[model samples]
Target: MAQDPPAQDLMHYESMAQDALRGVVKAALKKAAAPEGLPGAHHFYITFKTEAPGVSGPDDLLSKYPDEMTIVLQHRYWDLAPGETFFSVTLHFGGQPKRLSVPYSAVTRFYDPSVQFLLQFEAPAGEAAASAAEAAAPSPPPAAPSAGEGEAKIVSLDQFRKK
Candidate 1:
């Protein structure tokens, strides 16, 4: 006989872990917020939900990227401040500077292309629950390459060689 899994998660471990990961993002932002500003070729690409609560941005930017927006904190950005619940920064859009405030909960992805480090979070609760069915739909496995379609080879030359 096998034991059954618990139907309810009393400890809420997943949410706790998620919060912990968000904390890492916060810590990294705090480092970037310092005067040195993104040490030695290090930069970040942060993606967030535009409609999430506590997200503040210019009207044009919000309208332009209504669903999601990705911002690069590289050489041109200014005033990268990480706060208790949110981080605010000034970034240039189309030669104009705009300040944006996004709560950590709204952020879904954090990446540093220089070091190739990345952290991705699940979508906000409302969006996730709304699209649960679509997300749950299973897709068929990808088809294998026929011949020399990719870097890896399936057949060996020795298999056809005379003995």
Candidate 2:
């Protein structure tokens, strides 16, 4: 017989915690990106996927780092704008200014060395991330990999919807 209804969901709790932590990062970025600016020794080191969804940056600079890149937001940056889902800033490289826009979801680590605080996140997965991973990986010919080749069938929810 089935036991009493399960009471606690550990994964749900963990997801909530993760969201709250992400919010903290957003808040910190907002503060540091503000006009008042970094408020006395506060700076950020944000590391994120270069190929992840919603991440846009100078092609030359991004190509130098194929997978991940870390940016320090301390000085010599401009137009630091933090949006609801992403942030953009202008930074100097090789004596030239370059701009980058990164989605918060793509960020893997956020740190403040001055305060010795750190937050880390798992690699985010999405259409772009999945596509990027697929492009980077080698695959057999399309004809060689068929659904009947031990692959699970993909269900289309559209089949259940009214036309």
Candidate 3:
């Protein structure tokens, strides 16, 4: 019998690091969800995959994304309840308050301009539930005032790739 060759493995610490950073975003959202609303001009730009699991909102919105979508956290948002696994909120768009639920695991990117801190996450392997949830929810336009205008740095993993 031939002996097996020495196995070389890639270090996945990057994924672990990404998970830790996402925890930071979760913590911030939890804090903001508290009584005080987005203290000191602090806001968020959360981008996630529409197809990920545990996401709920609208079908049209998901259709528009077809893959991913970005949402903002600032004025005119209500009922922000952040839990260990997920967060729920209601935002007013076109003079109507639409509710949305997103699991932290579904989040692909998180950014806070006030602190210039950003985090990017990898899409999970399977996320059919997210799409189903969004489809079940009422349809709403993908219009967010803050998302319209901002100086945001896109966090792309390509930067970390080696030639």
Candidate 4:
């Protein structure tokens, strides 16, 4: 007897959920940009793919964090502009200021340690496969860390996945 094909996510619920969550990020940033600024000790740690499409930063910064990088947005940041699909901000690195533009789709993780809130996003299907393949290749030399680079709290999604 022939077996049926495995189930597929034709409804694209995952994409929808991710988009909605990104909206949450945008809204929070918008609120932070307000005159009052972030309220009650709220801060953010945004980790994103450096090489993802629509991401822009200094060449040195990109080379240092070729794959992924985390930025802390607590203090000493300015021009926190949020757009329809991307957000731009100016941050200091090594005593020099640099600007970065990151697309919401490029964000892999968002965390607010003050509130213990976290959101982890999976790479789109195609990119996930490509990233897995890239992982098999040899990596370049490790680069020095920039300012405000801190240890990231890792959370696995295996627990939420269906076996």
Candidate 5:
């Protein structure tokens, strides 16, 4: 006799877990936004989608980084503001100041090289629906590595899939 297929996930536990982790990013940014500024050597490298909803930045910047971009929050960044759903900040690009607004949902990775802490998030559902041509386009290169940076360690979720 043939066996039945395994049950599907109706609760979407993966999505829920991702949302909770994004909250962690939000909390960290909130802390950095305090008047005292980031305490100690704690800094952030935030990577996010440029096309994601609620994301806004300079037109030239969006063109240069059509897919995604990473920003460093170590020093010289200003106007750090974290809202309920999105965060905005000002950073200099080639000596020109530019403001960026990125929603929490757009963030894909958050790393603090100072403490070697990292968090990665799966792409949003909309990103997965892009056409083949779009997917084939080359992604922008990541920002330069900081001192003491190590090789990237990716965390896969295939083990959690139901057989």
Candidate 6:
């Protein structure tokens, strides 16, 4: 039997995993929204691309974050409305409150350190194929319960290679 030629421009599974992972974040937010507040101590650290499309926020914030910014969802955040395409929230910054609306597609990382959980995705590439792949499959297996709900899978890419 002969081995096949290496797959051409293989799709990155991590992106698919991110799609699945974003669902987890959306679910958590939904649960939080359902009861009028987040349960217990659950909160999120959302990191996103400031330059991505469909992202809107204060000009100062955009300037400060430049390419990427991380926001904490605790204590002073308000109006946390999660939607199918994006989420809108208000948080106090520099003693002033500001509102931000970011698409899920704009987000690059989400983490709940209380559970040691994280989900990371690649930045959008200005290419049709990559975009197609992303649109086709997004998300990953939900955070494992035993590993602590919502925890990012700490994977070593080298491990998957043939020895």
Q: Which candidate number maximizes lDDT?
A: 5
C-alpha RMSD of each candidate structure in angstroms? 12.3, 15.6, 8.3, 5.3, 7.0, 10.7
Which residue pairs show collisions in model 1?
A: none
Tens-digit lDDT track of model 3 for 1-163? 9999976657777667877877897889988888987889898878887667788986654565666767678776789998888888876544456677888888977877777776767676565566567669957545433432322222333333346
Q: What is each predicted model's overall lDDT from 0 to 1?
A: 0.75, 0.72, 0.70, 0.77, 0.78, 0.68
Model 2, total clashes:
0
Q: Name the weakest run of 10 consecutive residues (lDDT summed) in model 6.
A: 144-153
Name model 1 segments beyond 4 Å from true. 5-7, 131-163
- At residue 70, give the lDDT of candidate 3: 72
Worst 10 residues of 2 by lDDT: 149-158
Poorly placed runs, candidate 4 (over 4 Å): 1-7, 134-163
lDDT of 4 by residue, 11-69 (tens): 99989999999999899889878888789889888878888899998998678676777
Over 51-89, each residue of candidate 5 has an lDDT whose tens digit, in order, gives 898999899877766777778787677899999999999
TM-score of model 2 (CA atoms)? 0.69
What lDDT tens digits, residue by residue, belong to model 2 across residues 11-58?
787667766788888898889787788877877778778888888988
Please give the range of 10 consecutive residues that has the lowest summed lDDT in model 3.
148-157
Q: Which ranges in model 6 have alpha carbons more than 4 Å from their true place?
A: 8-15, 127-163
- Give, for candidate 4, the lowest lDDT window spanning 10 residues: 150-159
Give one digit per residue, the lDDT tens place, for model 1 in 39-152. 999978787878888899888768766656777776776888898889998875655678999999998888777887878787777877744664598543323223222121
RMSD of 2: 15.6
